[model samples]
Target: MSAAGVDSAPFVRLTAVTKRFGRAPPALDGIEGIVRGGRITGLVGPDGAGKTTLIRLMTGLMLPDEGTVEVLGYDTRRQPAAIQAAVGYMPQRFGLYEDLSVQENLELYADLRGLAKGERDRTFAELLQFTDLARFTTRLAGKLSGGMKQKLGLACALLRKPQLLLLDEPGVGVDPISRRDLWRMVENLTEEGIGVIWSTAYLEEAEACDHVFLLNQGRLLFSGPPREMTARVEDRVFRLSGTDGRRRHRLARLLEREGVVDGVIQGEAIRLVMKPGVTPPLGEDESVASSRTAATPPRFEDAFIDMLGGGPGGRSKLAETQRSFAVGDGKPVIEARGLTKRFGDFTAAADITFDIPRGEIFGLLGPNGAGKSTTFKMLCGLLKPSAGEGRVAGFDLRRDAPEARNRLGYMAQKFSLYGDLSVIQNLNFFAGVYGLSGITKRERIELMKEIFDFRPILDLSAKDLPLGLKQRLALACAVLHEPEVLFLDEPTSGVDPITRREFWTHINGLVEKGVTVLVTTHFMDEAEYCDRISLIYRGRSIALGSPDEMKSRIVREDLPDPTMEDAFIALIGASEAEEAA
Candidate 1:
């Protein structure tokens, strides 16, 4: 039956759909919704909120245990092929061939969609320009940076110009600038009357959608325009700033304990949502300000946090113990002297020299394809340097890579955990492989379960776990043996803001325990958490120092007090302009 008696039928419909594995509750429990045409509808929720499952169901990837799904008036179960041919679905990890060039990938997809040779050429050309990959048509997809890879994925999905597009977290791991570009593409699609159902955990991105579906544990909490949902909770928010930075976390904890604030940490400040009829203590004498005084209405993020029953900021207590090292003293954990890595005529990393102090939290900050990953791979012994020398924990990077590998734990940018294995099974496998045995391994496994609060999902398959839990489990496995130094490449990419905070807490804890950290991240705010950072551009280290020092050095005389983001833009802009000249 058509929904709400609208003359134009809904584009997509799900009625009482349920998907279950084993005896556990359904991954998607009796879900129902209607996606209208020519609008951008966001699916907003935390990990395991059934966003992916719904998308898969709609795209005919899996059969629902019960209920029915309809797309464009075609029943999904009976007419999946027809639905698949009419819709564009881009999964979280797109299926792009590394060996294929940009234009080749698009042409392949166009061919798969059964376009004729002439039509394929015309569509591919248009998509190349639309995705901004025209200049790099010959470049291998694997060689493209994270942001570029995402654009290519979108382009592949758009080859057919289907009436509907399903994007599953398409902006994950992309920088702010690249994200804006990607969104502009989506906006253009909607302008052309192509309906979209985009599932994402990033609330800021969700706010931009025409309508939003708030899901929790396989249940729909609300579905409507973002403004309507936000308006309901607008009066409850409060902006807070404190003189004691250290006390910010403590204060958030206290407010949470008092049951007054549903808050999140936004940089140095906390944005809180006050409970109904519960007044927050602003100051002893001054009048308590209304939510309006907080500057703007509460955002979708604010509403989502309130729905979760509010708590202390996403801070984890499972960090390693604290032990401070002198700022510039002691043997460097990693020392690179004129290190270089090249591929034919291209230099991936060029003449890089730096020393990362032991027990320090060091960061590599740069845009995608700035040689950060190349430098990281070289340091971790995954890739050999073409020239110069480097040491990891006093072991030569080139000559003693095996020895260096043993002393370091490295987490790649992608999800590396085995999906088919149970959480505990994965933990046990890594522990045993790392050489922990018998009672010791058992004890450590139990400790990990407790540390990550994995008891709830310990028996659940890792592949079936949500993104946030999977990330936590991955971190647990990486640190199981407690290596002396760790390398994290975009560890928090794609995680929600709360989970990102929790991940950092764990990282900070590792540093406190004298485990030197070398991490690469796209979130500029994360750079603030590092003791010192190295900014790379075009295969070279362009800037290196403490966050304050880098900021002071890069900002123009006229623009004084430039933020880290501003500093990064200015530094990269100046260097790129110089290189072009």
Candidate 2:
């Protein structure tokens, strides 16, 4: 059914919906909106901005403390079970049994939905074919990649033929290619008269929605088309290119200026957002005037930042403590030559080769389970490679694992801090692990505390800290020993935009101080921060270049200025097609 053929009716209605949790602020306060069938509605907001709570209310999993929530014309409080049976809710991870095969998972969901015996076979066939998982039937769910898991979760949700589908951040950790594919799958179903409520932390992805509900701090900030959001920052966005090696340092200093509202690294340049009434500060210097500074179209993210009172500006305080490096030594800081990792007869990473010089940020990008992690583990000395060499700080990882490890710091995706310990205790533990002691330990810990602004939360438990602080503590711990190389694996997965900018400011700062960074991230925006990128697939490097060069590889007359995301999708799609050929 096309949008023209489908009826445009409100499937879910919120009238003065107010929900409170404990004694803190209301999770959702006085939100009134209508979700129309036959269209995709986006719920855009930062983490803990009441998106999940609002979706839960519509599912009837929880009722609002005040006001009313009506789904499919049924009152949520009085007819909770009725709403649950008619709607499909796929939370972040979904309830896929990892040990079960893909086929068995589908069958289990069919059973849970209580489909008739005659209908089970038809539904199973449709979903397997629809999600393109027919060939991987016998494969265990745990063995599937991150993108495959999301597709399986969507298939499970659709098993009951739901009238309305509620997806909570389906693209959380999936790569750009996978994210685009999953989005197309969902958009196809909306044509069949199903309503969708997609909540996401990635504001850029939400721009395609038919309608969007912008939520922030338990309030409805905006309820309209995404274009309306972009309109808020019209003519305010600008991009300026600069000489090599000066972009990051300039970004730091420019962020503190009164004329600049928010600025981030854009390849070899900075994307600057000027404060209203302030001109682009190109400077009066002849060199600065000669450089190009052009106004670009405003995006959903720019509008979002403007709505939330602008982005994180200026240089990071954390960058001020470290001395800038001269990079006199021309040797690469981190090296992986023909690295291969095998478990039994299965190879995880095969013949991977890359190198990162001092003060460079090298990124390894790949689909989930696509050898990126395997290569990282080998380079970081967590796993011994079956062949080839992994070197850091001029030491062979296999022969001198301890020595190589000592010169590097790692921050895992989950932060990996001790939940039971307080902020100060975690800092102390990390300091000791890196061989700091006596006055050295105290001084480093004190520096971390002062730079990270942890004084208020020193006595607080690690688990209780917010997402931004958790990231800060993790980064602080990683750099406590001042390692020459840093390993950041998905450092800002589900964090909001402001926190991400702040984190990158510090990272760019560290890179200037001669810290070689080997990072892996699913966020393409973050990938732009890398000085160079190696995109791997099926245990092999498929594309390697600077961000601009990568994007230019797929450019044609029809598509002149392709984005990094367009480049990623095109490259992966071309590779897959080639493999099939």
Candidate 3:
């Protein structure tokens, strides 16, 4: 009754759980944890870290190979049906009838739960108001945006008002605004004394949870409050500023130094996570000497990475001679002149114009349903624009589409790798498609394997690899031929911070070698890495400038130190108001 003899009783508890599949390591290696009512419990880990396996066990979808899982004071193995009835579960891929309307889906779920007419009506109205889907009740669930569908799934889960709720990776593939709204609703539910178990790949979400259980490689590394975990690295973090060279140069220097655990560009400074009790090193380089290093507070991410034993060599340790860009009188590598795309009665992109200089990192950012993707597709020659012209690498996109594609590398938002093929097989196939033959192809494949440190997983199938490794494989294939320009659409979406930093480090290395990059992302912090960014909303480029420039434009006196995210929200709000008028 009391979590298999624990002193303090928990609403749900796992005692010495262990699960394994095939010849691989155990999915849950003797894990012990608890979930209490009236608080949000966060299960934070990278993809394939047993977060989903544990969630399934807790919800009675799977039984533990060893030990016991108790929920609501009942053993899950003995009484799975009782657990299912008392618990509301929303998996990563929620099941909602795509052809049915929003109201119809809610009605179906309510009837399945055997809710009375009065109860169903009251619950339906409440869900509609809370999820902000009241206006779209008649709309088909399939037609809803990704965020709306997630909300609809959540509403369906809450229809019965179960005592315990389980949400598995709800923020995956959703935009920032939708993530914020979903968290707000979860918090409100916790206030009503309903227990919640939330699993996520995003570490930042852990700060909002009352308790956190960190899993990695099927082991429970830490389990406690967020502050307690973050405090493990207190006074070890440092901020270095006033560097003289480019961001990559500074980052490279920091990574090269000893005692520097992790370093990343943070606005006008570089935040370094150092080893315990290690002092900042004094460098002979002028850029390093001029920098002012001071101790700073540690973030949750800092401790998490430190606990996991440092990142993949902060900024790519294996250095090579980088290709340089000639900045003389030459046309920009990418250009869009009055580009417009229309779908029947709807305009996806309208008169969008922008230019990306050679070797520059250009960012296209906006909320879901915005025109960023449309604009990107047109520039990549995937779609023929309804009006105007575009060019890439001095080749006209429309007439010279073949030549333009040869000079470019593109990674789509979706997982584009061959699933059935092994890592090396995918690499070979992509290399051949890019026209690499004989020694050149073999040499390039070897180089990519070294660059991404993908040698160990070469024999593994692409579908079985972890999400981070899959991303690396995709990027490696995209740039195998060393194209002049690279296009990334939501490249870092739904990835952990450490993996993102590693991916950006590779991108920075390419940028240093004169590779022009155009990227689209939802993470506001990533915008700081770009030379300039264009924010698209309602099929128009409303703002285009550096991250600092965009932040400076926010003149609201009530707000203090407005971040890039705040500026983006303000700009989009203004654009929406104008359209309504």
lDDT (C-alpha, whole model) for all candidates: 0.78, 0.87, 0.86
- Over 1-581, each residue of candidate 2 has an lDDT whose tens digit, in order, gives 35642455579889999999899899999999998887889999888889999999999999899999999999999999999899999996588999999999988888888888899889989999999999999999999988999999999999998889999999888988788888899889887878888989889877978889999889999999899888888889998886434678777777777777788887776788887887666664333454588889888988888778777776677777876666758889998899998999988889988878899999999888889988998999999999889899999999999999899999997769998899999999999899999998998899999888899899999998877788889999999998889999999998888889888988988888888999999988788888899998888889988998898899999999788788888888899999999
Cα lDDT tens digits, model 1, 1-581, are 12222336788888998998788677888888898777788988777778888898888877889999898888888988989999999998899999999878887887788877877778877888898888999999998988899999999898888888999988788866677788889888877778888888777778898888888778888888888877767678765544343423333353534545455433334456777765455543132221122533687766776677664343445553223343345789999899899999999899989998877878888888889889988888989999989899899987898888887877888888888999999999899777789997887888888878999888899888877888888888887777788899988876766677567666755665577999998777677667778899889999888876777776677887566777777788888888889
Q: Write the per-residue lDDT of candidate 3 for residues 159-250, one digit (tens) a residue.
A: 88888899998887776778889999998887777888999988878888889999988999999999999999999898777877776767
Cα TM-score of candidate 2 = 0.96
* Residue 92 in candidate 3, Cα distance off native in Å: 1.4
lDDT of 3 at 419: 95
Ten residues in sequence with the least summed lDDT for candidate 3: 1-10
lDDT of 1: 0.78
- The stretch of ten residues in a row with the least summed lDDT in candidate 1 is 284-293
Deviation (Å) of 444 in candidate 3:
1.2
Best by lDDT: 2
